[model samples]
Target: MLRYLSIIFCAATSFSIAAQGVVTLDSCRAMALGNNKEIKTAELKIKQAGYQRKEAAAAYLPSVDFEGAYTYNQKNLSLVDKDQLLPVKTFNPLTQNYEYELLVNPSTGQPVIVNGTPVPLQMALLPKDALTFNTHNVFAGAITVTQPIYMGGKIKAMNEITHFAQDLAISMHDSKVEDVIYNVDAAYWQVVSLKAKQRLAEGYVSLVESLDNDVKALVEQGVATRTTLLSVDVKLNEAQIALTKVNDGLVLSRMLLAQVCGMPINDQFTLADEDKETLAETTLRPATFNMDNVYAKRHDIHSLELAVKIFDQKAKVARSEMLPTIAAVGAYHAMNPNTYNGFANKFGFAFSVGAMVKIPIWHWGGLSNKYKAAVTEARMKQVELDDVREKVQLQVNQASFKYQEAYKTYDMTCKNLRVAEENLRMAQVAFKEGVSTSDEVLKAQTAWLAANSEKIDAEINVRLCDVYLSKVMGELKIY
Candidate 1:
């Protein structure tokens, strides 16, 4: 029953304390990486590029397509408006030829002629109705297969471009991950820095409270004046106000950190470093200044390189448009009202195999101009890549220099903090021995607070510097 009560009490007080859970830098980085919208977008782009690459690869193989069409006509097809013909022919084996039979006049036993016309004795009738065709529903369908014989290098270049695009997408994702990690680190450390300052401010308030008491007691005994007491009171109030400000800043900083970690802004959590008196010394890694290595490690640089290659392949694709293209085609055709069989109302099937060649003869130099533009675009990308390389190199150098200088600043602040602590201790002892005034002791305490605050700032600065340096070098690790 007691344990259950304790659990309930703790749960109730957790949010009030604004310290419910503990999270480390590594956990924060992982959370941000998993939840960041920009990172997710980049990952989606990579997937899209992968599908595009597959599509380009499919171009290397044959494709089959099917089409079917139907039509209905209101009227039957007519071959002739009126037709009447009668003629007779018999084979004459004696002459090895056919001759027309003529109508004979029985009275004269000779061929009959009217108006210089020979009359046929026998004839075959061809009626107009026989020439009419049935035309109601017509159906046509075809199944075609096409394989690229030679596309003047367009297919190959396009395939290569897709590969480059996929690589570029991956590189862009890596770059985004680096940026996310850097931002999360900055926010996390800022909260930790402010937490430390809050503690320092509270300590300062306590020291001033003690001084005020001492001065008040002295005034009652006539050793200190009322003016001195008022001064101590003012200092105590200032220190308390400073502590309040620090607390407010800490709350906001924690909120920002939580947002970066993809958590609710109002969520309560404690950082691993928040309770520590000092941040651990950062392990300084040696930086390699070799640009080749830097270029290899930096995702943005790699992305740019890939962009250049993609453009080069695009230029090749454009040039291919001006070249001759060849393709192999095969089809199976089926149609009703088969002309292959004397216009019978039955479906007829036919298969054909052929090849198509397209030669770009003249388009007013359009294809040539397009190819030239593509080449120019490729060259422009190369120039941009070079320009970015110079800027990134400078950025790397600046970040490295600042990272080193931050350590030096931290060391100096560390020394000043120790000195300040000792100075305050000596001043307190001197005042208790009645050799120094309370004002001197108050001055020492204020110096100590400033020193501690500076140290905290310096420590946080060093951490941020490391994060920035790693990012600029494109070596920002996951943890």
Candidate 2:
């Protein structure tokens, strides 16, 4: 009784653990999307694109800058003095009249006489240093503002290109999300399929064990040969080995699912039970496909469309580069020892406003060639867009066909499972009535196991095909 109680307790603990670890498909997809490295990188790309768009928009606004500088000169500036003359007037004692010295010769040391009397003597003057500049500390500061009046549409085109690039990043992020969902779905379904196969393997082992017991009893009663008992033992051993192998596979499959869901790889978990009958019923339901509108739903196609728009903007930008640009500029400057107003050695403020125009002149045909190259690139992007549309349609069609095929295969396997179950039942009845051999019973059991395994695979395939089809159609939504 104690042993039985202990077994029950252990069973309950395991069940509780499994119950706690149970996860749904949607939960796995959400976890993977949150933890996937690629998804995180794509999100970062979107943010970068947003920053670039803002940078482009900034070009449309006026720019203001402040500048300051200080300098020291080695020598002071000086001004030269001009030559001058002065009249000398004095009363001459010998002549007793007022005389003015008109001229004086430096070499002769005599004054010239005017009207028979000594006139005023002219004295020569030499130049002397008059003005000087302070060379110690010079400082200047300025605030300048510039607004682009006309850039030949270059700024507008660049802004549009950035906007288109942002859209492209969003589309690429969406595409990455879809890929993550598909991978999670595949791993989740694989775990489910392996669980089902493990159950079947356990059942097979039980059946073989029962057959071995019956054969042993028959051999003791002389109703069956020892060889029969040995044969049953061999089948039992093989079944047990197969069960062990299946169990290992199931554990690995669960681990794989855990890894995909960003959980600890060694952590054991239970999958939520899937309703196979309901899945089959839903899968068989008819669905309409609108191939014409499918391309619009594809993220890749959206990305390509945005690429074309970006290229178109590039062409406009290149052409604009060949045209003239115009701008309005204003500046307010102050400097120590201001010289523009006067010869004052003090700080003074001055302001100026003006307009500027830049025209593209001779460039050795460089501008024209660049414009032509841009046009060619735009055309190339258009071609790529067309190709992607075609490819998206093709992928959709192929996925549709594969879905159909998966459904048909699942149906066929379902029928096969029914037949195999009935065959196993008949073999058991015949073996009890002594109308069949142990070998025949073993063969039936094997066939039944094979059929069940195949049916599980078929079911998983159908589900995966559904996922693929939705992915190709761009209709898969995992929240």
Best by lDDT: 1
Q: Report the lDDT tens digits of candidate 2 across residue range 222-327.
A: 9889998888888889888888987788788878877876677897766675424324344363456776677778888888889889988999999998999999
Q: Please give each candidate's TM-score.
A: 0.91, 0.83
Counted clashes in each candidate structure: 0, 6
Deviation in angstroms for 379 in model 1? 0.9
- In model 2, which range of ten residues has the least summed lDDT? 274-283
Task: Summarize candidate 1's per-residue lDDT along 174-291 as a digit string, tens digits.
Answer: 7887888899899999999999898889889889998898888999999999999998999999998899999999999988988987779998888888999867889975655787
Candidate 1 is scored at a TM of 0.91
In model 1, which runs have C-alpha deviations exceeding 4 angstroms? Answer: 1-20, 86-89, 100-123, 285-288
Candidate 2 global CA lDDT score = 0.81
